[model samples]
Target: MKRLLQVLVIIFPLAVICQPNTEVYLFDLNTTGNQINITNGKNISNNEGYDNQPSFQYENTILFASTRNGQTDVVSYATNNGSKKWLTDTKQGSEYSPTSIPTTKDFSAIRLDTTGLQHLYRYRSGKSKVLLKDLKVGYHVWNSRNMLVSFVLGEPHNLIVSDLKSNLNIQVDTTIGRSLHNIPNTNLVSYIKKNKNEWEIRSLNTRSLETKKIANTVPNIEDMCWLADGSILMGKGKALYHFNPKKDTEWKIIKLFDKENFDNITRITVNKQNNKLVLVAEPETTLKPKLENIRWIAGNWKGEAFGGITEENWSEPSGGSMMATFKLIVDGKVNFYEIETISEVNNSLLLRLKHFNNELKGWETKDETVDFPLIKITKNKAIFEGMTFESIDKNNMIVYVAINQKNGATAIVPFSYTKK
Candidate 1:
């Protein structure tokens, strides 16, 4: 079975409601004598929800699927001025894989309707009409003004070529991946053939239906784009690789973005000029929240805060929660105390704390507590919305909290603690 076929089987049931949180990034690409330089990276789709499947409409404009107004719609973004326009706003369903129809101002996309029907449609002047009916098209690329090649969903998920003028659809291959493109400076369209052991990049001549193997894909990666120089670019992890079928034997590292927030790179594309590259990726901190990630925070700590001696004792995680108690001592006497807990809530972590005076009188109401939602959890850090906990080592730690002062100003106070 193909890799995309396996993914479709799992996601098809909740395809409409369970889209992942992904963002689209744009970069300026320059290739000079086998040295590829990627710079000026920008997050074009800064929205909080699913944004992916980017394709260049022109030299300065890009089209992609974006989640907005409770549905996925087509969004056109201008690379020159950093502007955007919503091209489709349909209440019936969501759209994906927006691409410009050859030699026309209109565009085509696969719209998954709420009734579980999927088809290809063309948009002209803000109106849409069905172009290929009764075919479950997932991804497509135009071969000419009236011809296109698409990945159609089925038991095996097939590669299909549709001729609009003749009202005919031809099945070219089966068990294919989602990345499809027109081979640069050729009359052929490219598709992936998933072999049992290794996947191969293959090309199809739309006119004669002849097929030929171009090259093996980059390990398990299938998403790629062709540059004007006939080289291919693919991403894995935080690195982007380059391959030239005419000269290279294997994929070579062109650039690595280890310090950036890009992760799980997929769905890449380049403009006609080949100077701009667009890709889809999840942010580095998008991992699911788990108590095991921050288990290092469990210990006894002593430090200083608010011109006083401070001490905190944290219990190990148990019963889906970690409890802690903090005390402040000034002038050799107890000043105040706080009760805090890190609890599992809705599959994420939540930090709640309450304040009390020296005599154990509550400073806030019984139900009132300062809450901080989990933002992200890294190897040695647990970052909440307004507070952060960092472990310097096994016996040392630091906690930063946002403090509202008496003069209506807020400040970040850091407490450095050493284990007793």
Candidate 2:
């Protein structure tokens, strides 16, 4: 029969290429509430505005930290969108963050000029070279064979090993204090934060400058990202720890939220193509006054985003649930999202929030549009902010909240989500 139907059409396309492809995402750099959902993960290139620190350029092509066009540059993307490049641009100040050196074609950026002092630049093709000037690199990294250049310089915070072959710069001895970076390929694991800020999860050995303090108690580590099954993903205080340095410790504690009043777990990012886990839960105090605006948000909440760009899942889906219903509905202004998800393909659910200071402080959201701008409505809590567009000249700013204190503190925006 025609050679068994040509071997079942070439073995059914290799069993659909060995089954794999279902990413769906739309928020990273830390996903907060106000209806920002993504299921699966990985799909960033819309609202490329305010895009901060994303490495990897040539496969899913990326190199973020952007202000789009009004300033603060360093942009490039090609997850297949074809072209959207701008290596670096600055008529002056603004450039603050950008890191990439993982399997490298070369990348590193920092141009915070204007006296805040931070002028380190190094781009490849489009041209732009500075490397080190004035000095004060807060958090910079580049390894995986881009040569070598780790950071966290001066002012009571050392550990700045440099060496682009022979330019050497050494400064190890990380007794570590106020640091939240340096963990890209184990140069000696990092995520420090001493002097009462609490955080501990260290591992320094700048070839043996020696430093070890892996989890002396993590209540809010806020520093993670080292997974390819090597597990090191973290997020403390409220809960979520998975350390496992080859069985040297903590293998799991996954998720746990509901601590006094939230705020302390500053950041933790990891999307491993979509295993999903991005948090930024911080709120030590903003005068929540007597917050209890909607009786601890009642119930019913869910999150998962990014379902475009050829569409599949993207990365934003993995056992989802969030129930913070009603507090300030129609008669009170607007703040309602009832999302439900399931995907063999698609299940409509979009959320949006982009506020880079429309008087609402700082906010960012992108799942898929949900109208914005409402600012305040206290009784249970309701605050808003908005602004969007990643490409037409970047302009992101999304913030949302509908707090009602119990564990309540749900609407606070401060921009810092990065994924492209």
The candidate that wins on lDDT is: 1
Report clashes for each candidate as comma-separated counts: 0, 55
Give the per-residue lDDT of model 1 (tens digit) for 1-420.
Answer: 366445544435325456778899999988766556789999999998999999998899999999988889999999999999999999988899999998899999988776566778999999999998878888999999999999888778799998999999999899998899999999999999988899899999999999999999987999999998898998865557788999989775555554457666888999988789899998766446887778888888999988899999999999999999999999999999999999999989999999999998999898999899997776656778767786778988878676776865445566889989
List model 2 lDDT by residue over 276-306, tens digit each.
4434443323223222321232222222222
Candidate 1 residue spans exceeding 4 A from truth: 1-14, 286-420
The prediction achieving the highest TM-score against the true structure is 1
- Given candidate 1, what's the lDDT at residue 169? 95
Using all chains and alpha carbons, the TM-scores for the candidates as numbered come to 0.67, 0.25
After the best TM-score superposition of candidate 2, give how far the Cα of residue 393 lies from its true spot, in angstroms. 46
lDDT per prediction?
0.85, 0.43
